[model samples]
Target: MRKSTASPAKRINFKPSVAKVIRERVDGKCSVPRCKNAIRGPAAKGTGSINLGVASHIYSAALGGPRGQGGMDNAFIASAENGLWCCQIHGSAIDKNAGEGYPPEQLFAWKALAEARASKLITDTPSPLGWVDAIQLLRFPHATTLPRLELSRCTLVAGVTASGQTSLLDLAGAVTQSAYAQRFIQREPSTSRVPFVEGRLTYATVDALDRSVDVQVLGDDIHRILEGKPCLLPPGDIQVIYTTLNDLQARPHEDDVAFLLRLLGVDRSALKAIANAIDLRLAPGPLRFRDGVEEDDHGVSHPRRTPSGERYVEAFCEIRTDELPAEVTLNGLSTSQQRGVILALLIAKAQQISQERLTLLIVEDLIVNFDSSKFMQLLAVLGEMPFQVLVAVPPARHNELLEECAGVATLKPNPDLSSWRLRWLGAPIQDSSPSVRRSGVQGSRAPIAKLL
Candidate 1:
C-alpha cells in the first residue's frame, strides 16, 4: 500500500483590530465606488443599530476561500491592508465571479476613495480591539507534503502504544513556545525559523497574535526545556510537562518531603494536601529520603541493580515515604497511584505559575494500569485544572474517551508502527471526496497575489 503523505495549508485568523480599522475607515458604509451606502442602521429592538457591512478580504482570507491566497506571506494575508468593508449586495457581487469581475487592484481603489471621503465627515479614528487568545491551527510537514490539524479548546488523541502520541505533544509545545518568544519577548529576528534538528522535522504555526513562524527552527532549544534544563522563555510562555515510565519512578536521591517542599513551595498546608492526594502516610519526623539498598528488618537489601556482567549496584532512583516501611518506587507503585501523584504534582505547579502563562501536560501509555473507575477519576481531576492535557490510551478505551473529550484524533498504525494514518474526530484519514464548489465564482481570471 502506498503511504499517505500531504501537509496541510497554514490557517490564519485576522486580528480583530485590523477588521475594526477597515470598517471604521469606510464610516460603516459600503466601499464600492459611487455606491457608498450606509450599512449600519438602527435595529428593530436594540438601542444600537445593526451593521450590514461585510469585512471582506481583498485576497482570500483562507487558503481554500474564494480567490485562493496564492503564495502570499501568511502574515499579511489577513492584515488590515487586505480588508474591505462593503455592503452585502456589493460584497457578494465582488466575490461571486470566481474573482474575475473585480480584481484586488480595483478593491484597493474603492477602499481608498471611501476612507478619503470619511476623512471629511469624521474627526477622530475609532480605537481598535486587541487580539483574542486561542490556539487556532497546527501545520505539520509530512515528508515533502504539508498537512494541518485544527485545534479546539481541548483535544484528545488516542492510539495504540508507541503510536507517536507523545511526539505530537512535543511538536505542539515546541512550535508554540518558539512563536511566543519571537512575538512577545524578542524585538529582533528570532531563531523560530531556524532548523534545529534533522530528519523530516519542519513545522510552522500561527498564534492568536496573528504571528506566523516556523517553530521547528528552535527544535533543539525546545528539547532542552522539556528535559527540565534552563532555557530563556518569554514571560507567559507555555510550560510543558511530560511523563513516561522513567518519570513515574521515584529517585533515590530525592527526599519525598524535601522534594515536595521545594517543588510545591514551602507551604505547610500544600505539603499535607500533596501527601494526602498521593495516599502517602504522614509520619512526624525529619524529612529525608532513605536509600533503597538499605537493609530492612529481614536483613535483605531491596535495592534494584542493573544486569551488567560484573557490576551489581543500586542503579535506580527509588524513594520511600517517611511513614511507610516499604520503599516507594515508580515501578513499585500501582498504575493508578503513579498517575495520580504525577498529575497532582504537575497541576499544582501549573497553578502556581503566573495566570498569563499556559501549561501542557502529556501522558503516554495512559491506560496501562488504570481500570475504568481509576481512569474516570483521572479525567475528573484533569477537568478541574486549566492546563491543556494530551492523554494516549489504547484502542480499547478510545471510544469511551471520545464521548467525553472536546475533540479527538485517532491513529491507525502501520504494520511496523513506524507510521500511522490520522483521522480527526468524525472524518476519514484521507479526504477522498471531490472538492466542493466555492461560492462567488463568476468568471476565471489569473489569480492575483497581494501582501498587506
Candidate 2:
C-alpha cells in the first residue's frame, strides 16, 4: 500500500496592511538573526516600492503549511501576530520539511530579536553632532600598556621619535571606524599586552540615548561581535582629522590646503577669524595676514619661480595689508610668519567643522617650529573649538604645552629596549621622571604569558 498524503488545506490570504505592519516592526530587515538582509528596495523602473520579503507565519496560514498545527480557527491564522518578516529564502526553508527545522518557538524568537534591534536603532539615533567623551584602550600593539584614557578639551601626547604616540592616536581612530579595533583584537589577541582581557571600547551619546557603547571583543569573531547590531558612531557622524608631518610644511601643499578647508567647512567668517589671529600675533612686525584664497588655482597648481628666482604661487590665499603688495608669495614669508599663517589656517578649519560632527583634530608636531608665545596661541585656539584635540609633540616642548592642557601622556623608551612605556601625566610637572612609576604596578607586571 502507498503512503497516504493529506490534500492541501484552504489557503488564507494576508490583509494588505498586515504585511506593512510586520515589516515596519522589524525595520524591513529579515527576522533571522544571521540573515537580516534588506528585502525591500526601490522599484526597478517605477515609482512604487518592491518588497522581496515574505511575511511568513509562525503558525502556518493553512492546515497543511509548516507548523500549521491543524484544527486551529482560520480567522486568527493569517493575522499580523502570526507573521515573521524574513527573506524569501529563509521563509521558504522554514515552510519546507513540515517545519521540522524551524519550529513555532524558534520563529517567534527571531521576530522578537528583530523587533528589539529595530527599537534600539530607532530610539538610539545619535544627535547631529556629539562630543567624544573618552577613548578607552582595551588592547594595543606591542608591549607597552595604558589605562582607560579620559579625554578633555585638550590633550598633549609627548614622546620621542618612534615612541608610539602617533600609534596610539591611530588606534583611537581605527576603533572609531565601525568596530575595526574590536575586530583586530578578536583576530590577533596575542599582539595585545593589556590588563583588560575582554577588549572593550565605551563612548557616550550626547542626546542621552545611552551612557556608553560597551563593546566586548575577546573570545568572539567579528560576526559574533555584531550579532545583528550596529556600530556606535553610525556612518559619517564622527570625523578624525589627522595632520601628519607631511601636512606641517611651511608652505602647505595646495591640494592639502583645499582638502583641509573642505573637511573644516571653511567660509568667509572663518577666514576673517584666521586673519585676525595672525595679524594680532604678528604685531610690530612689518607683515600682516589679511586673507588667503582657497588655493592658488581652481585645482592643484604648482609653484613657479619668478624672475627674481623666488618660488611663488599665484596668491594661493593672501597674507597682505595696505602697505604690502597686492599678492603675497609663500616663499617671501619668514619661518615664524609662515608658521603663524599655517596655525591660523588649521585653527580656522577646525572650528568650522566642530559644529557639524564629533570632530577630532590630531596634530603631529605642527607647532614644533613655533616660538613659545605662538605655540601657546595655537593651543588656546585649538582649545576654544568644540572638538577634542590630540597634539603629538617631542619631549622638549612637553613643559611648555602641558601647563595649559587638560591632560597629558608621555611615551618613553624602556631600558630593556623592548617597547615604549606610556605614562599619564595627571598634573603639571617640573620633572618627567617623577611622573613615571617605574617601580610600581608596571614594574611588577610580567609580559603577556597567555592569550585568552
Candidate 3:
C-alpha cells in the first residue's frame, strides 16, 4: 500500500455582497417556514440596530463541514445561490450533529417557500395564523395552582401514573372545545361540571397581531375576554384534534377501518394514497376491502338493510401477519400496531389540510405501547408535519423524550398528593411558574354567545 498525503479541500467563504443578497431575498426574515423571526431589529439604545441573521451555506463550505463533502466547484459553493438566510436559532439548528437529519433537499424547499411568502407579503397579502405559544391553567381539579405550559412546535408532557398528565390534556381539550374532549366529558359524569376554571391563551395572528385572551369555563360553558373586553371568539379559529387510548381501543359497533376513515375525513381511495405517500406498511399485504356479513346477538347471520331498504354489506380491512396462519382484520393486530396506524392516519390528514388556520394534534400516552425504535420512527414522521403537536408520555421515558422534543413539561404530585407541580426542561421563556389564581363559583354561561 502506498501512502499518498492529500491535503483537505480549502473552505469557501461567501462574500459580503452575496450574503447581503441572500438576506434581502427573504426580506430579513428567517427562511424556516412559519418561523418568521425578524433577523434585524431596532436596538434598545439610541439610534442603532441589531442583526441576528446568519447567511448559512446550504452545502458544506469545507470537506468536513455539515452537509459538506459534495464535489462542486469552489466558486459555485460560495455563490449566493448556495446561501440561505436564517435567524440565529434556526441557523444553529440546521447544522447540528453534522446535519444528520437535515438534508439539502429540504433546505432548498424551505428556501423556495420563504422567498414565495416574502414576495406575497410585498403585495399586501396577509400571512397565515401562527401556532399557539402558551396556555395558562388558573383553576383545575387536583391541582392547587397549575403553571403556564409554554408550547413549542413540538412538546412532550411526561409524568407518572395519576400525576396529572391526563388532567393537563383534558384541560387543553376542554378549553378548546374539541370533539374528543367533549365526548369524554359527556361520558364521565364527574368531569362534566367544572366549578370555575379561568385561563389565558397566547398566540399570534396575521400581520403580527400578538394576543393573549382569558377563557373562563364554568360547568359546560365557555367565555372569552380580549383586552379586558368580552369577545365572541378568539383571535382566530384553532382546529384541535385530540386522541386518547379510548379512541384507539376497539368499539362494538364500529371497527378501526371505519373509525379511521371518518376521523381522516377521506374516502378509501384517499386512504390508500396517504398510506403510499408516507410509505407506511401495516402488515405483509396491501389493504383490501371485502363484503362482510352481519351477525345477530345469538351468533346467527342476519340480513341488514340500509335506509333505502337495500341490503347492507359490511366492509373491513384484511391484514396478514406472520403469527397468524390466516388473514385477520385490523382489530387482530397488537395494540401498539394499531396506535401506529392511527398516528400515520393523523399525519396524513394534517398534510392534506390547508395551512390558513393553525392545527394542533394532542395524543395522550402515545409512548406507552411501542418500543423505543417504533416510537422514534413515529416521532420522526411527526417532525415533518405542518402543525403543532403535544404528546404525553410516561415518566419512565422522560429523559429520552426530552432530547427529542423542543421542550418537556414534567408533572409531579405534591407531598400529600393533593395537587401537582410542573417543571419545564429545555428552552428559555419569560415565566416558568404559575401566576393567576381563581377561587369562586359562577353561573353557567351559554354554550355560544355573541360579544357585547
Judging by lDDT against the true structure, name the best candidate: 3
The candidate scoring highest on TM-score is 3
Model 3 segments more than 4 A misplaced = 1-129, 160-163, 175-195, 212-215, 222-237, 249-251, 255-258, 261-288, 294-327, 399-452
Q: Per-residue lDDT of 248-296 in model 3, one digit per residue for the tens? A: 5544455444566665657878876765544364222334444555698
**Alpha-carbon lDDT, every model:** 0.45, 0.51, 0.57
**Model 1: CA > 4 A from native:** 1-147, 159-164, 173-208, 211-236, 249-332, 399-452
Ranking by TM-score: 3, 2, 1
Can you list the residue pairs that collide in candidate 2? 292-317, 292-318, 293-317
Encode model 1's per-residue lDDT on 236-270: one tens digit a residue.
Answer: 34544454443334455544443445444446566
Tell me how many clashing residue pairs each candidate has: 18, 3, 0
* lDDT tens digits by residue: candidate 2, 14-39: 78799888989988888875574668
> Residue 419 in model 1: shift from native, Å?
30
State the lDDT at 295 in candidate 1.
62
Candidate that beats the other on lDDT, 1 or 2, i.e. the better one: 2
- Of the two candidates 2 and 3, the one with more favorable lDDT, higher being better, is 3
